[model samples]
Target: MNGAQSLIKTLANCGVDMCFANPGTSEMHFVAALDSVPEMRAVLCLFEGVVTGAADGYGRVAGKPAATLLHLGPGLANGLANLHNARRANTPIVNIVGDHATYHLQYDALLTSDIVGFARPVSAWICESKSAQTVAGDAARAVQAARSAPGGVATLILPADTAWNEAERPAQMLRDIGPAPVSSQAVDDIARLLGNGKKTTFLLRGSALHGAGLEAAGRVQAKTGARLLCDTFAPHSEVGAGRVPVERIPYFAEQIVDFLKGIEQIVLVGAKPPVSFFAYPGKPSWCAPQDCQFSHLAHPHEDAAGALAALADALNAPAQSSIRVPLQLGGLPKGPLNAMSAGQIIAELTPDDAIFAEEAATSGMPLLVTLSTARPHTHLPLTGGSIGQGLPLAVGAALAAPERKVICPHGDGGAAYTMQALWSMAREELDITVVIYANRSYAILNIELQRVGATGAGAKALSMLDLHNPEMNWVKIAEGLGVEASRATTCEEFASQYAAAMQQKGPRLIEVMI
Candidate 1:
């Protein structure tokens, strides 16, 4: 068998069956080998960005790694932005990048570039296969690295010669390394800190933001009265009714400082310390209070759920979660269809077990408060402070959990970056409802411009932030891409269209004209 055939078999054996691909000549052999392995499902994406972003979504929702196939250096480079997002989210991904034949590298071909340098920043582990005999083993190791601690991108560079050459049997799955346990002594130390009279807050991420970990945190909070908070843009969080409330830290530094002012100690569990996304003039980068102490009971790669559970046990916590968000609904808006009204309509209509992939920019902020009390669902936000991830992210989430409906609330500006995802959604006939918030501008950048102290902005400076000389018609775009769509200008119109979309199942788009 050829190396590509063996590699595909090994990947499937390693429990990675989904592959999002945008390949070229160097990867033709691998593409051809897909038919040989019936287990590995290869999904075609029009753009490399969508390939990587879809992998990120699948990984987050699937609780495992998903493979991505790219052409070469330029192709890997094309997908790097979403890879950056995947890296920051700590999502597991087996990124397979094809390169020129080993013997032809000396000729300085047109596509020959430093693939290693291009992939290094985003990959937790990277390697290039030297020959067909070793390619299967390389694939096994790549899967192991991707599934390792907190999870991350593992890039395996398969040379063209390595894929086309003859190879032997597929390698067996490697033993997955699980998160380290939080020592009993460490748990005692944190338990004591929590028992103290000082005001404390739990900064949670990763596994701590959902499931058993979240339950344990709630019990501890009920016993100790500690506050719970998560990062501003959480990778994946369980929100809405029946889940413990995890308030997100505010986006701006000043807002974060105000949000966390009274906290005396911060206990981290698979989370980073509070810090600003970017440096601003005269704003503190570190938003935590001066006297606040910090302790890490569990690192991002450690057993956060176990740590929280142990801490709860040590504190003699209650048997059940202290308080949960009760199922509730608010009145719908009637006149104008703005961000607030849109959020209300979405929250009111969202069914239980739905998934929301949001990159709604300025338009999504108003929805957060209301969504907290909506039907239970998973919320996946942009973790890398990058735009253009929401649409493709929904594509992967829907594919990963086909039984659940996926709703994407995306800004017009961000949606343009990877709108090709819509075609893939239609092609796959995924159950995704995309709501494009077309405000005719990069609304977030306009706010940032003033925050950064860029004063005296003229028409030219302001023009750079605007999206309106020609407004994009999302309905036409969606229709052209094979997905049925509609446009909504008033609150009554949006409420009707969105409610109808939520009740049905195929790929659909609703342009929320602001």
Candidate 2:
């Protein structure tokens, strides 16, 4: 068998069934091999950013790595932004980047560039296959690396010659490894801290913000009178009725400091100490209070859920100590569609078991706060602080869990970064409802300009932040991309359009003029 076939077989055997690809000439052989291996489902993405971001979404939902096929260094560069997001999210992904033939590297062809150098910053593990006989083993190891503790991105650079050459046999599939156990001493220490009666909080992320970890944390909170807070940008979190509610740290440093004001101790669970997204002129970078003592209960690589459960036992938490949020849908607003009205409409209409991918920037914060107590759903945010992740992430999440409806609330400025994802959604017939907040400007940047101490009244600077020379017709754009869409100018219009979209199947878009 050819090396490409061997690699595909190895990936399928190791539980990687889906591949997001935007291929070029160097990857033709690997593309052709997809037909030979019927088990590997190949998903075509128009842009490399969509390819990488979709893989990130799939990993968050599937709890396994999805492969991404890019052309070469340039193509890998095209996908690097979302790869940065994936790295920060600690999502499992196997990047298969194609390179020129081994012998052709000496000539430095037009597409030839430093592939390894570009991959090092975003990848936790990287390997270049030297020969066809070694490609299968390399691919197997790449999967192993991606599925390591807390998951990570593993890049495998494949030369053309190695892909086309014959291999002796397919490599054996590697076994999946579990996360490391949390230390008993660490759990006991956290228990003692909680027993001291000082004001304390549990800062959560990764697995500790959802599922069993969240339940254990709720028990700890009920028993110890401590608060529960999640990171500002969590990769994935399950929320809504019957689940424990977690307050997210505010994005602004000033607001975060206020939120954490009284806390005397912080027990981190798969999260870092609160810090500002950027250094402001007069604000402190660290958001925690000056007297707050930090303690690590569980690292990201350790078993966070297990650690939380053990801590609950140590605290002597009661069996029914978990706090459950009751269903509380807000009433629909009756005026023009501003942030508040829009948030109310969404909270009233969002379906149960939906997957919400948010990139609404400043406009969506109010909506997120409203939906915190809405129906049960899974929330996926932009973990890497990158824009243009919402739509593509919705695509991947829908693909991963076909039974669950995916809802993406995107900002107008950020939506332009990866709009090609709409076409993919239409082609795949995915159940996704995209709500674009058509403010016609980079609202977040405008807020940042003020935060960074930039003075007002400059024509050029204001022009750069505005998107209104000609307003973007999102309805026309969505129709052009083969997806049904509508424009909503008022609260009633938005509620009607959103309800209609949810009732229908396949992909749809609603442009809310706020």
Clash count, predicted structure 2: 0
Q: Give the TM-score of each candidate.
A: 0.99, 0.98
Q: Which stretches of candidate 2 lie over 4 Å from their true place?
A: none
lDDT of 1 by residue, 13-42 (tens): 999999999999999999999999999898
Best by lDDT: 1
Task: List per-prediction Cα lDDT, in the order shown.
Answer: 0.94, 0.91
lDDT of 1 at 94: 98
At residue 216, candidate 2 shows an lDDT of 88
lDDT of 1: 0.94
Candidate 2 residues 193-268, lDDT tens each? 8878799999998888778888888888888888999988988998888888788899999999999998999999
